[model samples]
Structure formats: structure tokens, C-alpha cells
Target: MVVDRASSTRIVPRDPVTAFGIGNVATTGPTTVRAEQQVSTDLVDHRGRIDLPALAVLFDHLGGLPYFASDPDGSPCVQARLAISMQGGVDVGDRLTANAELLMHDEAFGTTRVDIVTSTGRICSSGTARNVAVGRTFDHNPTGDRGAAAPPGNSDLPGLPLPPAIEPGLDGRVIIEQIAAGTRAAGNLTELLNGRVDTVDHPLGTGVRFTVGTEPWMGNVFGTMHGGIIAAAVAQGCSFAGQANAAAGRDYQVADLAICFLRSPAVQGADVVVEVTPVKIGRRVASFDAAMHAHDGTLLSRCSADVHYR
Candidate 1:
């Protein structure tokens, strides 16, 4: 894809849009987008920590926000891939900032560089995404229906109101073992979940409490947790949830996964508690909601997933 040299000249600086205690503003050029925000959170988890997944969405959006704002036309772009790497952990009252710049572009494709930093001048995360310009202006504005909405099944409580008890028929240990085995086959899956996760008395569908490991490759640059790992945990939760509600031996495929960060879990000595509950059970499709919390019981992130069982 070719970067548009002519598009960069039609740039604008707009007012910051503030919501959920964060303010975001952007400046764009024809072929590039850069955005900045002072991260703040009006929402808090049980540990009184700032939400983790919610923050991720905001930061992630900031990385792409400029592309739409500066588009010569009003059309919004569709993200094909989003990759995130966290170097540091952020907390409540900790300011998070992001800069998203277009690295490459053409009529059909665009690549962007995304970075997230904290107020203390620490780089929290860095990543990139490939965007497909859908050839239409963004039809909605942030001030109204087009703006951010609460994630599906999102609630004030950080975790499931009634954590599922270990079921009698399924062996929770075997399910956890299967998960561990599955992750081992995936790149760095062993390191991601290893001894960190615990399987209770129930089966794969049961909830597990995980301790954040201090492996050298573990924590973010700031010696805290990374959102990517958290996503992995949530993915496993959804997989198990869907599998549990499906016919025996059925394979589950994740169709969509969306998470919101409410607070950042501590990188070290933090325990992650996640429970996945099936929301809908159709013959082929299933929906699940997963909640994650820090060891101290404060909510960190929430996930909504759609899975297909075949």
C-alpha cells in the first residue's frame, strides 16, 4: 500500500472527547494519525483498582482514532488485525497516553504504529494494526449513538455474582490439564499459564484462579502485567465455556472476542480469577461472558465472546 502524500496536508486539530474519565484528542495528516490522552478512570474494581480491559479498548481506539478524524472523507476504517505488547502496568490515577501513526497506506490497505505510555514517561505498550478503508464516511458522531457504549452484559460487579460450583460429572483437573496441554502447543502457552493457573474440582467449564508469574519474560517493562496475556486467559475461558455447553468432543471456534479493562492487575503477586458463563446455547452458536479479577478481589477486565461449536 502507498502512503497518500496529498492526504497528509488536509490535517485538523479537534477538541478532546472525554468520557469514562479519559480525554482523547487527535491531529492527523492525509496518510498519518497521532493521538494523545491523559488516562483516568471513573470506574473502579473491587480492589479499588482502575479497570484493565476498559483501558485497553480506549488505548486501542486511540491508536486508530486519528485515521477516521483526518480522513479527507468521513468514512471509517475497519481493523483487520490488532497486536498489543505491554511493557509496563498502569494503575488508577496513572495517566495513560497513546500515539498512533500511519506507517503505510494505499487505496485498500493501511498499516499503523500504535504506542501507549504513562504519565510518568514510561512506555506501557506498543503494537500495530492493519486497517481496510471501507470507502464510506463515519455515519455517527461520538456525542451520540456512535459513541462508546457499555460492553454487553457489563456490570458493576467485577466477577460473576455466583461463581459456578464444581460440577459432579466433569473432572476439573483433567480440563485444566487439557488447557495446559493446549497452551503448551501454542507459542509460549506454557509460560503464559503454567503453574500460574489452578484447576479446581470441576471440569473445563469450571472457573480457575491464576497467579501472575514473575518469569523473566512475564511482566511488562514496568514489571507488571500485560494485557495480551490477560486476553489469552479470557480466550481460554471462552473456549472452555463454549465447550462445556456443547456436545461431547465438539470443537469450539471463537468468532468474536471483545474485552474492556476496568483496572490493571499487579504484575507480580497478583492472582487472576476468571469465570466464564454461557449466555446463549444454540445448536451451533454460543455466547459467553467472562470476568477477571485481581487476587485482592478487585475487577480488572470483562470479556464478551461468541463461539461456534461444530
Candidate 2:
């Protein structure tokens, strides 16, 4: 991945069709198209964190939300406080990997810096840009005067806090439930029931929860919940994060995902909880890292996934 250097001119309107360069393709070379397609595909998978440009795409598709920064044309663009970019990882059997994050953004310049991380969660590429709202005459409109203390569009980019249970419709909780419905849980599979929203807008972490019953169908020969069950639970949490990030307006597709089986659960009936951590909230892409654990604090499994916002 090639990250562009952050600069004031970078923010200036280089493209007229799109306002903030949110959809601006930064890297152009012999491999630009191939690399971008790869990144775009990867960001849409459920295995890992989404890419920066993908996030940029989402920002544009979702309306020109100012907190996300935009170019003079009102397209989403990174400001001084943050930067956006993409990174890649390896794909082993049954396992996926990638990384993403929010580096920095310029509140004054209306730009931000972001670093694309690899599967191991390391920065691989980076870039910077600035933004300004030019009126119809191509005049610079001071964006900071509405409420000096407020952010771009003012207020904390109005968003919904993640629900604790798998409550769809209320916030697309039904979709998660549908994904979990037919799936068989290990050990007392019947014990598993509908989920509930655990935390919304978590500062430390976020995700949903469900009650699993110790049923006979849930176990393999070892009499434990199958690894598939754990993986599904973790994946569901990641999906929840995507839905929450999109605010139920747009849909997200998983590009890639990675899950590490840590331990096997001894009991079939237990309160399973999945925690989602937002690694990077880019314009076209969004990433969420999640882990599954039992009520007794047993680390059942951990997973990270990236989603394409469109």
C-alpha cells in the first residue's frame, strides 16, 4: 500500500466532480488499479478491519457528514485531526488478517491523517490532506465559525450507540438474529437463545450478547461447543458493529476476517458476550475487532473483521 504525504495543497480541490477527495484515488502507478481492487475486495470481507479509502467511500455514500471532513465540493475528506489509508495481510486456511486505524486529523485545515495497518496491526501505508468549504463562486467559507467549540458540522457526528442485545429493526438487530437462528451451537445447542444488546457507543469496547443453552446438539465428539459456534458468535458481533456504524441506513459487506480459537467452553449453557472495538472509521471502509468469551471469563475465541461501507 502507498500512503500519500499529508500537506495543505493535498486538501485543496484537485478534483471537481467529488467535493472532498473522499473518493480520490491517491495511488496511481502500474499497480494502482490492481492494488486498489485488492484493497477494495479485502475491505469488504468479514475477516479484518476495513481500508481507509473504503471508509472514505462510505462517508461519501452516506451523505456529506462534516464531522468526517470533506473537500470544497462537500465530499468526505480527512482533516488535520485524522488521516485515511489501507493495508493488507495474509490469508491462511480458515483464518483472515488485516489492520486499520485513525492516525490524526486537522480541525483547522479540515484534513486528517490515517495509517493503514497490516494483519498484525502494523502501519503499512499512510497519507494526509486538508479541506475547505468553497461556496458556489469558489470562495473559501470559514467552517469553524458556526460554533467555534463544535466539530465540523457541530455536535459529535450524530450516531446511534450499539445496542446490547440482538435487537433488529430497533437497529437491525433482526439481521444478527437471523444469522444465528439456524446455526447449531456446541454442547446443549438448544440452550442458545436470542441475543440482547450489551453496550452502545462504548468508549472501551462495543458489541451484542446472547444466551447459549447447554444442548446435546451443540457438542462434537469432545462434548464441547464446536469452534464454528464461537466463530459465528464473534462474526455476529463484528457485523453488529458494522450495522451500528452505518446507522441502519446503508449496508456493509465483510471483506475479510480472522479468528483465533483460544479455549473450549466446558459448559453448554452460558452467557456469551462479544466485544467490538472500532479500529478505524474511514470514509469507504470500517473495521471492527471482536472477541467471544463465556460468562465465567473464559476466552472462547477472538476475531477481527473489515467491512465495505456503500
Candidate 3:
């Protein structure tokens, strides 16, 4: 996802969301735009709930429409841009709630802005983005239709790294790799479990399906799966989705996230599963919604997330 006239870069995970370099990550397709309610993803396996920070990305992914290629003829010629202003987020499970709305469009600039609200409806994050037309390819000059002019070159963009004044902690570092790439291999997830869990298969967009036994070390002061463990799973699921839509040779960044807790997951003898669905896919921004459920069909938690694709 090259935005404006920026050079290509990679993405890295910071804390909760995955980001593409500092601004953009390549995507599999174009932005998916709509104001419809869709099933998006399943967040059933998360223990208890996800944190506010992690959940916001889930929402952003869902809000964006799934990207698809169009026929060379008859499709409208237009530039699409997606921007998000994140309101505050709530802490449910280990994740938060991120609220945002799409802003207006500018034909000349080929971009749009959005308003992001928190669960409590507070403004937490906001930014604007610019998008220009990137023309399509065709054979024989395309008999029925014509293509937009190619975007101007962006060969002079500068490197914008994270503020040098800050550094990342160990957990934060692990989160970067986990989310920058897709879900860890089943063996990796099992290694993280230290042999205390078993994984199952549930394809068809269901992200992660696994079972964990109640172990004393896995318990928190609240007598359930520890928040860290739950957060880890949620991060893995969201990260996997990020990788799925990610363009090769770039990293994804999480811009915002929101999560809702439906129920407490049992720490002992219970299993959990995860599912992911995308919401929006802007040139520089991306979003998704996910769910975690127990084996018995209890909705343990729901999450939304937003990311800046680099």
C-alpha cells in the first residue's frame, strides 16, 4: 500500500496494532467501502476478552470492504482514500474499544478522512491521508472503456521512523513479530503454550482454533486465563489477518483498536477458537473485526482493530 508519493517500506507491530513502516504497507487489493453490517470475523477463542488497544484494529479491518479486482470495462474511474480518527477505547478483557467514522472525500486530492470514537465516545487518534489515481492494465486499449492516467512518480519520499526518543520493551518486541507476520505456526503456538494445550482445525476464515487446559501458571489473580495470555491470542489472530491481506515485502501497523467482552472464559477444561473478518481496506489504512468463543458456543469476546498499511 504505497500512499501519496511515498517510497515502499516495511511494517512492524507496536504494542497492539500492526503498522506498515510508519505509514503504508502494500495490500492484496483496493479499498473495500460500505456502511453495511457484516459477520466479518469470529473472536470466540480469546480468553475472557481482548484489551481496548488490540480490539480497535479489528473494527477498522471490518469497516473496510473486502478488496476485489474489477472488470476492465464499465467500472467507474475514481481514486479512493481511507482515513481514520480514533476516539478513545475501552478495556474489555485486555483490549479496548476504538470508535471512528469516515470523513469526506476530495476529488482533487483523491483522499478522505474519518472520525474515530472510543467506547465512551472520546477522541483518541485522528489523521488525514491522500490518495491519487493508480491506473489499471488492459489489452487492445480496452474496447468498451478507458483507464485513468497513472499516478505521478513518488521516488523522493523520505524515511519516517518511529520517534527515536522511545524504545520498545520485551513484550512489545515479541508483539511486533507476532503481528507483523501472520499467525505463528501451530507448532509455535504450541511452543508458547509449553505443552499445556492442543490445537484443532476450523478453516473458512476462522483464524485460530485451539484448546488449553487450566494450569496454575495460566491463572490470573481473577482466577481465569491471565490477561497476558488472552491478549497474546487476540494479537496472534489479528496479526494473522494483517499478514493475509498484507502485500509482500512490507510490515503492517495498528492504528486503533476496540474490544467487547461477552463472557468470562473458563480457565480449566475449556477450549477456545478465533475467527477474523476484514472491515475496510484503504490505501494507507486497514481495519477488521474478530471474535473468540468457547467450545460450547459462548461468545467470550469481540474485538475491532485499525492499522496503517506500509
Best by lDDT: 1
Give TM-scores for every candidate, taking all chains together and pairing residue i with residue i.
0.42, 0.38, 0.37
Candidate 3, run of 10 with poorest lDDT: 36-45
Q: Distance from true position, residue 127, model 1, in Å?
A: 1.2
Candidate 1 — which residues are off by over 4 angstroms?
1-17, 28-32, 36-38, 69-71, 135-137, 140-310
Winner on lDDT between 1 and 3 is 1
By TM-score: ranked, best first: 1, 2, 3
Once fitted onto the true fold, the runs of candidate 2 whose alpha carbons sit more than 4 angstroms away are: 1-193, 203-214
What's the CA error at residue 185 for candidate 2, in Å? Answer: 20
Residue lDDT tens for model 3, 1-310: 1223243332222211122111111122343222111111112112211122233233333222122122223222221222333343323211222222223323223333323334354554444333332243323221111112221122332222221221223232233244234332222232233222222123322233333433433443334443334544554566555545555444555555444444546566566666656676555766777677777888776767765665
lDDT of 2: 0.38
RMSD each, Å: 18.3, 21.7, 20.8
Model 3 sits at a Cα RMSD from the real structure of 20.8
Model 1 C-alpha lDDT per residue in residues 147-245, reported as the tens digit of each score: 233221223212212212333454424545554555322112222243244443343344444444322233332333444456556655555555446
User: What is the lDDT, from 0 to 100, of the residue 20 in candidate 2?
Assistant: 14
